[model samples]
Target: MVRKLVSVAITCCFVGSVVAEADIKNLLEMDLDEILKVNVATGTSNAISEAPSIVSVITQEDIKAMGATTLAEAVEQIPGLHVSNSVNRLTSLFGIRGIRNNNTPNVLVLIDGVNIAEITALSVPYAFRYPVNFIKRIELIRGPGSAVYGADAFSGVINIITQSPSDLAGTSAGVNVGSFEYSEAWINSQFSVDDLSVALSITRQRKGNDSERVTQYGVLQRDGEFDNIHVNATYHELTFNGWYWRSEQEMGSGAGIIGNDIDRDISETISAQLRWVTDIDKFTRFETDASYTNHKLDGLFQLFPEGTWPVGDDGNLFLPPLLL
Candidate 1:
């Protein structure tokens, strides 16, 4: 079964590429033959004619046309996928095919073939954390991908490919503001020097309130701030990628989990990768890659005090004070 699945995935690559060039309007007009020629690379490197599973590709053009600002928003456009909130409302969740979890650990997310899922937590790292500015395209494969991508690819896989120097050609900057005291600014630049291509992007965002109305504990005013930096460079078959992201969010009562508690949650992620690829023969290829990733969490939550209290039949024994 695995071999057959692999063979089918190989065939879909070629077909995916053909359909990629067609606009949404033209796509409906294309004949079945043209539709079968659409090419995709998420399943395998080979361009097979048949696909073993469902795959959805969102190009950069589609992103711009939809005015999507974050990766989560872009993904929400895909069928059978929805953006959900974690129990504590601290993380964004990707719920696919009605399957939901606290961390959305059933899904696998990657950037240019590099895994970005948090190692210890085994979940999507900082959901909606990635800005769409540098993304050239996104390929999402729904269903089990363990045969090709190993464990944690249980429900789906999302592959994000960043733009190259040729894609940007110059520099750009933008800022936006919205309700709830939301504001963001970003700058990106791409250029070529000699044989090397480089692209860099930086973004910062702040939101004074999450817009969630507290019914019982009153309004705690959940707030969040984020900063991200991305860099990519390629020289011939050798490529390098770097990403750094930090976020701080004020946890507002945690959806009544800890009632009226005021605390903060902070997280940071750093990742870098170096890869070299070479063609060995007409039908053979060789590639090597090295990557490093780190995720850190500094959180404060209010819980019951450490000391214990005596229990009495009256149920009014001395109660310990809340601890931070």
Candidate 2:
């Protein structure tokens, strides 16, 4: 099913890119597609072209252009990744080479080298509730990285690389409003004082599928509004570095019709990390990362007495004929 058939959905979700052409003239002048073709000279020895595996590098500029709210959404740009919208709000299912279905753990998710996929559920929560605007870039390796990343690296690997203090050396902000009253806002900045460098960012956004009302199976229903807030701060340099990230999300349809209230879901995560990098000599350097993360999920569903509901699967409901 994954081989002979190919489906590509190119939806242009607009993002405000009105940066004065002169502000970033250097970047604006360069052809991003061409630049991406070159291999990265710095960082780990494994360059894009040199690696023995398929790797797609997605830059912040690409992310901005796509207006993607999550990592899974951004990776759709890769050639082999097929898109599938799962029924579960908390999970996303995608595969390459016909390797994915309702159950697949071949993809390993990493954020700054830290594995983020849930152990029990076998998937990373990629819903809009997560903070992805803070991402600087993403690297998807369509092969085994288990030699270095350990298990969960069999099918592929996803690296969510966030911005460094130097990347946000100045204040920057963006807000977008699109069809369906979807709105997003983000602000980021960096401060430097002698030997210390600091980066801070905050983002908030909301989107709903049914801006008015939606009928499913003849039942009048409304999609719940989804909202999220994220905050992060980082201090880094040669000797030592530290960072903290926190985010919260909530979704609920405000008191549904017939008083059969819709369920509410809330999720939150907090993370902190400390790292030390030491250069022992001209040819050798050592670095280590110590980190901690805590996540919480809450779901609230309403129960109604049997036979007390009038709404049908076809969205057809019978109300006492309005007395004129």
Candidate 3:
């Protein structure tokens, strides 16, 4: 339970074991209300254990034991939250409570209190699975949190805390492999100098299609590979966090028609945040934060295979023999 959990692919990993002991906060032992009372989930800067609600906490240990290699798989363990598939791109759908949409925008997702939900094309990020190799613990609020997080918190909130210098003893690395040619590897490093502390983690994974999904057209291709990098640094009350992840894979099916095997779906996202906590006066302390995130989804889709004539001279079109 002391090892770092590496998230790879949706089919290979299933956090569907999400809790390890929280490093400094020891979240595994804390009550749900006490956990929610912190992390800016409320307007008042005070404990609110008196509030009634349902919640769940998963630590690194829990995530590893459950064979979870992706954030989506780990989150599936939460009660009332279901992870489904989406055809729009290769992304996953998050259904909380009774509300299940293409993207499930009602549920807010955050990493270190910063929102990562997509604002344009989808609800969550562009990728189907996000690596959890750098996670410390995941704290969840399974009910309305509009008062603190705004409109996106209607269904619930998933707050992810990344590892800190104190969380890592030194350096750690591991590799994971599963069926369907799925494989993953990750490395983590932590160090301290004077008052400065830094933690860095990187992960890479790839998977091949199961080659068993057959349709009228033919078999489906779901092979893909992903790379992720995360860094966290702390200097006094100021902290800096950044992340980057890229994914490329063949269309599981296709947006419109069966994509050519040569076609692929690619997506990339990057985010950076700077946070500072200082005392406004003698009694009250104020927290300030600034962040930036960019997400892009792009791909080459060949609905019609090569050697096929889209504009045929003859009135009747000739189809590929295999397609028939």
Candidate 4:
């Protein structure tokens, strides 16, 4: 697969007449052992481990090197993990260590110490999903953490910490435009007033693709748009700190040639939390956190008879004669 990726990358550059950016020295200087040596679980109240349990941390620097735009893309590089991008933009199935269970939520995902797993279904939804630009670090701890954190932490725990006031103390903003007329813009700024710290951010993204032919049985839709606005507040101290965030997204779909229907989905999330940490003694400390998130989804579809419309939307039709 690596060879195939390399070949594709080479062919892309050759056909497009574009220059690729890479650090040959950094590639040669990379050490697998050293890269995996970083400790992560110690910072939290979770159980301790004698030996690393297939753990790894992808730093912001590492995320930049990969030039990936999605969390799934960044996580696919982890050993023993497979990320499957399904038809639904709000669905992603991941497997780890040969545990390929489709109907179970074996993997747990936490953002800023809060569990973001979907409760209505068994897996995580990609609609209100977190983005990479807002990420600070991704910590993966393989094996079961259910005993310490609770259910859904079976396969492992993926903790993604978004950029905080401390991480983005200065000012940073950029715009990117590329193929398919795809475009994106983002801003990360911080402010300080006395002991209180605050940060604000906004992002927008859109793209159009016509790579796949539309069909009734197959995935007839292949385009999407996303926009998000975020804010962070913090009261920095040795004993306590707190923060909160909210975002919204919309995904568009194209109808097959048979029908003139347009399907689109809209979703939003509002999350808030409070956390307090206090030291009981020299070597021990107690921590507590509470949070809540409200998420919703709305989709519009079409209705047609059997075989009448090769590619028709899913609209319930009952008591047709009376209702019509």
Candidate 5:
């Protein structure tokens, strides 16, 4: 049997109103065959009539229609791709072509060509923490991209293109509320002056529960409060992106959930990236990117009392308590 691969391509022209209008008009006037022949740029630097690998496109319109609030929800619309809850439920796992892993380190994710996978954990943070409101479109490649993207593109690659100044046209803001005491608000704006163009977006979200429960030692486990902030800005050929996420939740029964407010686990992630791009010639280009990411976990598991000590093999009490 032959296995089938699928890729996604986003087809919205976000340069400016004039170009967008013209492209829309042209698309409307094109026949089915012409539309099918449209080129995509995800597989290579140059656009090709057809993607070298199986490809699919998800446009902003589709995302809006589906009312997807997160990147994982938006990606679930594509065929052969499924999103699952991580062990902690605070993160997400991506499954493609029946392949699944704990951390999903095989998939590569890019934002405007900058890689956002956490270096230490080797996981795509965008899968769980990314907001979809500021995205212009997404291009998904459903086959191996290691040849072009190097390692971590073991299974596939996802390239997320954010809204540009021309795409925004003006300032906009929105608020969202949902079950489980979830709420989110965001603002986005764009403008251009002379040769310089600027686009900015910021979002904040808060939630009470992550929506999954675990059972350990015959006790029920529940997640806790979560907060996240994301910011993206672009000026001319330079771009900056940053995200901060924090979770304050009970450490679960396995960690000896001492009390509702006593045993706690706090996880925090901070990431930032600055990128610049320029054209050296008609057929050549240069790009540079700098990034910093940190993931910290601090908490008191409290498997035993603070004063309790552990006995060593020498049958003597150790100096320090065996704090989990």
Candidate 6:
């Protein structure tokens, strides 16, 4: 139940898989015990597990074993974190170490070492729905990380790692359906041309507010649909990833009013990242990273239900007739 858990999830499932370009053989054989011994900082060589903060890492196997559907649900299993829904949009919201708020502010989210948090809101839009099908692992830091990760890593950091080619293992697809009219479908494929390897995933999901207890205005209509595409490629020392996601989420309550159910919030986001790594010597490694992201959101709000506003020539609200 970490604040910005959705963003962390979206950072994982939104962008999807990762490419283990350099040192694939070594990375493929490393186990959790070896991972725990890995050093993050190249300068001071600090161990992530025993550093100035408390840290936890959750593997993909762990999530699958838990039978958790969403990334928020998976992260909530950790202690000292919580996740809940926002009032109007019903987006994911939670807190870290008792620092609770409605929106994400103090937490920093990263996917494969790339920053994907929306600049203005400091979190992904609520419209960005995340599924757990594509995640590889999650890293949580419960204390200060500002000195290493910059200003946004105040309360904690949720670093999501994605699946590699060895993990995906060619192509696979699945579908999920259950109560509340919820359904999800996804496909993952991987291929290699000579030394260039590529992995891709596409997902579509929808959920209906069928539960009488899901919203305050149970009589009003509420539902949402999401589509996402992700691509990861690698050629020796160079690696790249790109993602496209779109969502149309219904607002169960009109601007948080007690009993008003209104319209929808729609959004689209495109993100890309590139990285390079090389061994400088027997004891040194050189690495560089770059990323780019663009996103847009629109709230189609309705103050009242249908027929509340006068119809116009275009079927939208007009200036109304002049009073005599």
Best by lDDT: 3
User: Residue 23 deviation, candidate 5, in Å?
Assistant: 16
lDDT per prediction? 0.70, 0.55, 0.72, 0.57, 0.63, 0.68
Superior by lDDT: candidate 2 or candidate 5: 5
Least accurate 10 contiguous residues by lDDT in model 6: 1-10
Using Cα atoms with residue i matched to residue i, what is each candidate's TM-score against the true structure?
Answer: 0.77, 0.68, 0.78, 0.70, 0.68, 0.78
Candidate 3 residue-pair clash tally: 9
Listed per model in order, the count of residue pairs whose N, CA or C atoms clash below 3 Å is: 12, 8, 9, 1, 7, 4
User: Model 2: per-residue lDDT, tens digit, 1-324?
Assistant: 011111121111222223344656445535553324322222243425556667778888898798787666788778887656444443566676566765347777766655555443465542434456778888777766667566677777777667777667688888877775567787887787776776766766665455355333233322333343323344443322223333232232222323444444444444455565555565556665565655555554554424545667786654445411
Q: Positional deviation of 304 in candidate 2, in angstroms?
A: 5.4
Write the number of the candidate with greater TM-score, choosing between 5 and 6: 6
RMSD of 6: 9.2
Report lDDT (Cα) of residue 264, candidate 5.
61
Q: Predictions ranked by lDDT, top down?
A: 3, 1, 6, 5, 4, 2
lDDT of 5 by residue, 111-214 (tens): 76656665444665422457787887777777677777777877777877677666677888999998866788888877777766667777766655434443
lDDT of 1 by residue, 1-324 (tens): 000000001111112123255477455545643223323333444322345668777888899999988898899999999887664545778878988787888888888766777754466554346788888888777787777788878888888888766668789999988878888999999988899999999999888864466534346455889898989999999888888888888755433233434466677877788877776555556666777777777666554323333446886544335321
Clash pairs, model 5 backbone = 7-54, 7-55, 7-56, 8-56, 8-57, 9-56, 9-57
- Judging by lDDT, tell me the better candidate of 3 and 5: 3
Q: Which residue segments of model 2 deviate by more than 4 Å? A: 1-45, 67-69, 126-132, 211-262, 303-324
- List of clashing residue pairs for candidate 2: 217-313, 217-314, 217-315, 218-314, 218-315, 218-316, 219-314, 219-315
User: Which portions of model 5 miss their true places by more than 4 Å?
Assistant: 1-49, 191-196, 210-300, 303-324
Summarize candidate 4's per-residue lDDT along 36-82 as a digit string, tens digits: 43333533322223334567778778888998776777888898888
Best by TM-score: 3
Error of 4 at 249 (Å): 7.8
TM-score, cand. 5 vs. native: 0.68
Error of 3 at 225 (Å): 0.8
User: Candidate 3's residue-wise lDDT over 21-55, tens digit each?
Assistant: 55755453356543445453553323435234465
Cα lDDT over the full model 2: 0.55
